[model samples]
Target: MTRPVATKVAFEDGWKAADTITLDETARYRRRMVMTSDNGVEFLLDLGEARLLRHGDGLVLDDGRVIEVHAAPEKLYRVAAQDPHHMLRLAWHLGNRHCPSQIMEDCMLIRRDHTLRAMLEGLGAAVTEIEAAFDPEGGAYGESHGQHGHHHGHHHD
Candidate 1:
């Protein structure tokens, strides 16, 4: 059977999805792939390049059906500094290590690692474990998944 093709994209509040595709951080980025929804609805996501799909982006099928993309929950570390200056310093260190981190206003989230945990603690940043959707910055040069692809206000609660 020819799977439904999703060519258009929608931001979180724009479209109501007929179904949802929960994907981990790694599986979310793709130019072409077959995805099966929770209800067993299968489709093709051909974005033409690897793009980071955030929690509420939708894939619009040719038949006007929408499949919402949800960021799957994962174990991560929440890091916070005592002050803004310290936070900036910690961010720099994480960036230097090429860590994939979700930079929030008050804290940052990264995949938990003992070495990284130790480093952050030594740097005077508090580290805590949390379970949430992991949506890190793509990079200096990365594909903008769709409209409002820039994750400005999206963060863990």
Candidate 2:
């Protein structure tokens, strides 16, 4: 069996602005040591390679990833609590933020599918329900399943 290769989670500490590893406000952290090609972490989005256009009220990740939290509820509440107008915007994102996507609980690390489902299960949802909702063609994207393809299978909690 092939041994697991090492991976670089973040940029080396004490890295300078001029360092070859170029990351802007919305930066995409690539896994260097393991897979240099595939993106390891997607934190901030460097909008069209501009430096001055940095996100102000974003998260400076533990790994210095600089992920821009676009109206994340917890962060929004912290930053703009006093402002009624800004708070309204926060409420909007909370109500309409993508469902399948999971929000991070802490400021440390972001979680993917299985981990996210586990966290959601803690709240009051199931992985199978979410998966079925996203299934194309027959999914309950917006329309309820009619007298069409219906099936069931084993699922893990």
Candidate 3:
């Protein structure tokens, strides 16, 4: 039976659609959702069941669950991008998604983090230190050099 599709997402600060969202067809779910509105804001999103099937080019859920779409990945992506709660529920199920109350805490931590990381990078800490704050484990941290820290960067590595 198709489980009832309850609210899959709840924004911390009631974000306007089209701001921090993007769709992923082959991934079988919402790809990039910048979790802002709470406080500090971070670019991270939960993965939905839509991505749980083939287990190949799928989204590795925030819960550390790998879900690849074997059927209609694109349709599922539309469903997740249009609605946020269901996507958020996917995170809740993973046991990593934060609660409304914790939103503030997460924000505070993330903001301080970015600030410190920026400061560290500004102070000329090794590229590794800066990357650690933004992207740990030497993964694709991918930071675009910005002028005033706005999303837009004039120069990119």
Kindly list the per-residue Cα lDDT of model 2 for residues 1-157, writing each as its tens digit: 3322322122223433211222321232222222111234433232222222111123233344343211111111111223455434433443353422222221111123454445434433322431111111212443322212332221211
What C-alpha lDDT, on a 0 to 100 scale, does residue 11 get in candidate 1? 70
lDDT of each: 0.84, 0.27, 0.25
Q: What does the lDDT come to for candidate 1?
A: 0.84
* lDDT (Cα, 0-100) at 87 in candidate 2: 39
Q: How far does residue 10 in candidate 1 sit from its true spot (Å)? A: 1.3
TM-score of 1: 0.91
Model 3 clash count equals 14
Task: Encode model 3's per-residue lDDT on 93-113: one tens digit a residue.
Answer: 323322111111111111123
TM per prediction: 0.91, 0.19, 0.16
Model 2 TM? 0.19
The number of the candidate with the highest lDDT is 1
Q: What lDDT tens digits, residue by residue, belong to model 1 across residues 1-157?
A: 6889987677747677899989888888777887898789998888766677777788888889998888899999999999999999999999999999988889999999999999999999999999989988767655553335555365686
